[model samples]
Target: MLIREATEADWPVIWPFFHDITAAGETFTYPFDLGRDEARGWWLLPPPDRTVVAVDEAGTVLGTAKMNANHHGNGAHVASASYMVDPAHRHRGVGRALCEHTLQWAREQGYRAMQFNAVVETNLPAVALYRSLGFEVLGTLPEGFRHPRHGYVGLHIMHRAL
Candidate 1:
């Protein structure tokens, strides 16, 4: 698989997976009905931030990640990132690769730490992957998410120093 910077042309391939993943209510906190324009702006950030995608040998997008500063001004040294893998491509390490790439990019951009602000507690695979990659659970918000199936679930704040 090839991991590369995402282009505007890649949105068509990313939208379906982004829509479905957000709608699933299993991981992300985004509204299931989030509009296209907002999603586009969120994914394709300007300047300092970067977005990337993982594609198979055939160029089918398998996953993606967007990374940027966790906050502004004095807090700018901390970075944050979000990731999504096509459900059909789960268990294939796409998420891992995207994360690895994102981290490297964050370091190159001079970030001192990386954080995930709202990781769903029940998303074990993702949580585990983050853990394996050196992220530690900083805290958890009780009943932070209204999971469609699991009712109320905790949202974790995971962080790693660069």
Candidate 2:
């Protein structure tokens, strides 16, 4: 698979799965009814922030990741990121590859560490992946996320030093 910076033209390809994922309300905290324009504004970040997509040999987008400083000014040294893998392409290492790529990018950009602010506790696959990649569960906010089927679930704050 090829992982590279995403271009504006890629948005159309990305939005379908992005909308599906967010609407599922299984992982991401984005509003279920989030509109295209608002989603675009959030995903297609500019400048010091970076976004990338992973594609197969046929050039089909398999997954995407966005990375940026977790906060500005005093907290700028730490980075944060989000990832989404096409449902049709799950369990094929696409998410892992996207994560590895994002980590490399973060290191290259001089980030001191990376933090995930609101990882859903029930998203076991992602939480496991992050732990395997050296992230630690810093803490969990009790019943922080309202999962569609699971009622209120904990939100994990995970961290890793770059």
- Best candidate per lDDT, number? 2
- Report lDDT (CA) for all predictions: 0.93, 0.95
Supply candidate 1's per-residue lDDT for 86: 91
TM-score to true structure, per model: 0.97, 0.99
For residues 1-162, could you state the per-residue lDDT of candidate 1 as single tens digits?
A: 899889999998899989998988789888889887789898988778888899999999999999999999999999999999998999999999999998999999999999999999999999999999999999999999999999999999999999
Model 1: residues >4 Å from true position, as ranges? none
Task: Show model 2 residue runs off by greater than 4 Å.
Answer: none
How well does candidate 1 score on lDDT at residue 80?
A: 96
For 1-162, candidate 2 gives per-residue lDDT tens digits of 999899999999999999999999999999999999899889988978999999999999999999999999999999999999999999999999999988898999999999999999999999999999999999999999999999999999999999
Ten-residue stretch with the least lDDT total in model 1: 42-51
The candidate maximizing TM-score is 2
Pull out the clashing pairs in model 2: none
